[model samples]
Target: MPHPNPDAMAFLLSRRSRPAKTLRAPAPDRAALEPILTAAARSPDHGKLEPWRFIVLERGALHRLAGLVEERGPDLGQDADQIAKAASAYRDSPLAVVVVEIQKSSEKIPQIEMTYSAGAVCLALLNAALASGWGANWLSGWASHDRAFVEQGLGLSADERVAGIIHIGTETSAPPERPRPDLDTITEWVTE
Candidate 1:
């Protein structure tokens, strides 16, 4: 016999990511967010490599990031809207967690596996935030991909990559439920 946790399942089924732009103030306090980060850290990591780390960007940090985006814009040939969109994540966000994938040199654990673990951490963080009653969204723009931007903006190392920027805050409006994948089309049952 197996015990089923219906509430957890129901919550998973109903979880929807709130838009980053629509998230407002009064984000999770340190006490409130600590547990969520703990939950996120519980994500599966093969061989326990722990190839990921998080940078919590609060209000002032966001402003600094926004300023960096503005400063780096022209050099990257980004126009106003593009620059604005890149900066908007910081400009509007009350709080965000930058999931950084730190690639470790290991003979046993492959780099791809490390990358996957980092990705898992990103989703775990997002889900944790949502489960904790905070609106959260994962975002990565051109700035996130730019080498200079990552190094200068977030102080990432050569072996590190941005897994995602998980923005968390109060939800201003409820987003309508979007379409889900058709299980029949996506799944295949095999029998011998």
Candidate 2:
């Protein structure tokens, strides 16, 4: 007999990311978010490098980041719509956690593995936020990719990069569920 966590399995089966546009205010405060961060830190890291970090952006920081997005857009050759969309993500976010991928020097662990660890941390953070009863969405756009935007807005080091920015807040409306992928189309069976 095997002991399985039905509740955890149920949540994973039905989990859906709430769209950032539909999320409102009343995000988790520092005290409330501490456990979420702790949970995210538990993600697997090859070599135990812990090749990732968190940057919690509060309301004021989000506002400044929005302005920084606008300032960097033109210089980065972004169009008006692109700039607006990117800026709006920061402007409208009640709170966000930027998952910074740290490239650690490990002879045994390749850089790709470190990147994978960071990505896993991002998913863990999103799941933690959702399980805490907050609406959460993982997002990254042109602004997040632009070097100048990352350096100026996020103060990321040369070896660091944005893995994902997770927006957390109250849900203004419940979005309709979209169609999921067919397992047969994507799954593969190997007996070799």
Candidate 3:
């Protein structure tokens, strides 16, 4: 027999990502966010490599990142619209957590697994924030992927990469539920 947590299941099923632009101030403070970060840290990490780290960006940092996006966007071949969108995301965000994936040299654990673990941490952070009554959205764009921007904006070393940038704050409006993938269409049953 297996025990089922209906409340958790229901929450999971109904979980929705809040738009970063629609999120406002009054974001979670350090105390409020500590537990959320803790929850996110509990995500699965194969071989216990712990290859991910979090950088909590305050409003000032967000604004700085927005400027960096503007500076580096044109060089990266991002058009004006793309630059504006990405810059506005940082400029408008109340707070954010940059999930930095640090690749570690391991004899047994492969690098891809570490990358997957970092990705898991990003989702976990987003979900934890949402579950804790905060609007959260995970974003990655040209700025996040650009080497120069990342190194300058985040001080990421060569071994580090941005897994995701998770914006968290108060919700300004309730977005309509978008259509979800049909599980039957995406899932395949396997048996041996």
lDDT of each: 0.92, 0.94, 0.95
lDDT of 2 by residue, 1-192 (tens): 999999999999988899998888999999999999999999999899999999999999999999999999899888999899989999999999999999999999999999999999999999999999999999999888888888988999999999999999998887899899999999999999
Off by over 4 Å in 2: none
Evaluated at residue 3, the lDDT of candidate 3 is 100
| Model 2 per-residue lDDT at 192 | 100
TM-score of 1: 0.97
- The candidate with the higher TM-score, 1 or 3, is 3
Model 2 weakest 10-residue run by lDDT: 142-151
Q: Which ten residues in a row have the lowest lDDT in candidate 3?
A: 141-150
Cα displacement (Å) at residue 169, model 2: 0.3
What digit string (tens of lDDT, one per residue) describes model 3 on residues 139-163?
9987898899989999999999999
